[model samples]
Target: MTVVTSDILMDKELLHKKELANSQAALLNVLDDQKKDSEKILKKKAVDEAILASIGDGLVVVDKEGKITYVNQSFEKMLGWSSKEVLGKRIVAVVPREDEKGEEVPFNERILNKVLRGEVVVTDLTNPFYYIRKDKTRFPSSSIVTSIVLDGEIIGVVETFRDITKEKEIDKAKTEFVSLASHQLRTPLSTINWYTEMLLTGDVGKLNAEQEKYLNEVYRGNQRMVGLVNALLSVSRMDLGTFIFEPEPTDIPLLVRSVLDEQMPHIIQKGITVFPTFGTNIPLIQVDPKLLRMVVQNLLSNAIKYTPEKGKIDLSLTLTDEKKCLLFTISDTGYGIPKNQQHKIFQKLFRADNVREKDTEGTGLGLYIAKAIIDNSGGKIWFESPVSNYIEGEENVGTTFYVELPCKLLEKSK
Candidate 1:
């Protein structure tokens, strides 16, 4: 009995030793796996840091409350602000934004704040704004702000921007060159215009019918050239921030009526039926009469020119419900702007493919100029194509342009 008990105890000891060895081996394997995971995490963090440091555009990240969290190296270098100085500060208070007129953007209107409030804000190059730097100097910048979402919730916002100082310089140079060339060309163009006018009026001896007809054609062509030169001059002035605005209490309805009268011949020639709906008690607003006249003329003429024979045009001028601004709307049964190319319609020297194919006479600067004028005058201009219902049929879809202007003159800055 004693010998049997001793053999069982010896076997139990051997089994206990084997179980301890297996446990130790499993522990070592788990430690090895943890070490590999730590190494991988560190390497990935380094790579991400390197990429953030190497980006050429300035980038900033802020929490949902608009507190600065991370600013890339480019942000520090471009804004002359060190990350240490700006970390944890309110983004809007650290950096100021200004419109083209040098008016400070209101705090509540800041894009960061809007993003925090759950509004999606996207800006393009067309709306370039100035960002003030640490030293109180400023540069024009183009930026995009996007919300950083996690688990279907917005946790923060990220903004990426780049300095467009060089772009502004290049654009100014181009405008200056255009202004000089236009000024130089005006002298010869004026001389040709005066002579052509005198010949057509028989101040010089009149020849046969053929000669008179040829001279009339020359006069009309010269007039068109003069018109183009004037448009270019106006654009150059606006771009260089030298355009002068002389605002006076102008009758909006009368202005529209005069423009319509001037364009009546062409409208009648095209057989386009006109419907003018001038709202009652439309107040006289403070605006530049000549500039306003030009705006109306461009819109009316474009509506008439693009519409086909027997097509319809509806023009309405009314005060908003608040009665603080005027709304001018013009819609036409014409070749609507193509869907894909609608975004480029207001660009300088850009014409839609449909328009270019239909009419070769346009300089493609009409809408561009009209927008520039309205924007400078504290008015807003926009358009909708294929006018609303968008029925696809034999008749081409049309476009509607809307312009809204404040009642009082706006203080503008250079």
Candidate 2:
């Protein structure tokens, strides 16, 4: 009986061991399937990321600790660093810094601190800081830094940068061209004005009536030529980024009235009736007086030049919205601009064909210069005219040019 019991016990133990082996094989198969699925997902993610990293613009990803977790191919190519050199390194090791004298300091200064504080920095990095290239050389760049936040927590930063050396070179060339051209044009213009004045004053010698009349014509032509040259110079200065605005607190109503006074002679000569109106107690505006004067002069000049003899021009200035802005309107009974031509009216050297045919003496630069002045002064200009052809007794159906300027532009000047 004892021998039989021992054999039975041994058989039961063998069966238990086989059952355990089968259970272990099932678990292994399940784990293998899970591993394959994870690997497939990881591969897909890597491909998507690689495509993004291959773009031309630089890209970087940092962890909450400001240590670089991932960097793109473009970023590596831009900064002369490899993945092994930059991964797990602090962002300060890669960002450029500048010294007190506006020179690159060539030291690692942390940028993530400022970014994590929720500041969006956009700057022309080419001016003071540059990216070190793979060849151990530096290149000019412009970059923007924006904070990355998740669930109200600062996670990291994203920086985009590009080389701008060529852009800077082009800007420099443009400035040089404007400076040289302005000098060349102004010199001849000054000489012309001086000589014309001398002749008109009879300082050189006395002249007969015929000679005097011819000299007067020459003087007038030269004056117009000088105005054109000056307008061109101002436009060039603006294009080259040399135009300066020195704003001062000025009375808007007074300025408009002064412009009207200066234009009175022409308004009378044209036989056009004039109506000037001012709103009660208009506030002063902060503006470059000279530039604002030009804007008003240009608008009035256009009104006078376009209006028919015996027509009317109305000028009005008013403070609106509780002294928030100064509104100016100059309406005219003129040969109204065609609807199609109105859009092109402010383009440089663009003249309405109808106006050119009627009055062949316009420079076509007045409106262009006026638009530029208004834009620089933080003002806006627009005009309204009828789309249909004009009929007799409908003289008021002409163009009305409106300008709106902010009062803050005046308050800040104070």
CA RMSD of each candidate after superposition: 3.7, 11.1
Error of 1 at 130 (Å): 1.4
1-414, model 1: which lDDT tens digit per residue? 699999999899988988989998999999999999998999998899789879999999999888899999999998999999999998888998998889999867888778877885654466589999999999999987888889988899989999999999999999999999999989999999999888877897867899988888888888888898998899899888899989877888999999999999998898999999999977667788999899899898888888889999999998888776789999998988876666677888888777676789898888888998898788999998853332344336778999999865422210
Q: With candidate 1 superimposed using the best TM-score fit, by how many Å does residue 394's alpha carbon deviate from the native?
A: 8.9
lDDT of 2 by residue, 235-339 (tens): 667655678898888888888889988988998897989999999877667888898899999999889888888999989998776777788999998878776
Off by over 4 Å in 1: 1-20, 111-122, 207-217, 339-344, 386-395, 408-414
Q: What is the lDDT of candidate 2?
A: 0.77
Residue clash pairs of candidate 1:
none
- Which 10-residue span in candidate 1 carries the lowest summed lDDT? 386-395
TM-score of each: 0.88, 0.57
| Top-scoring candidate (lDDT) | 1
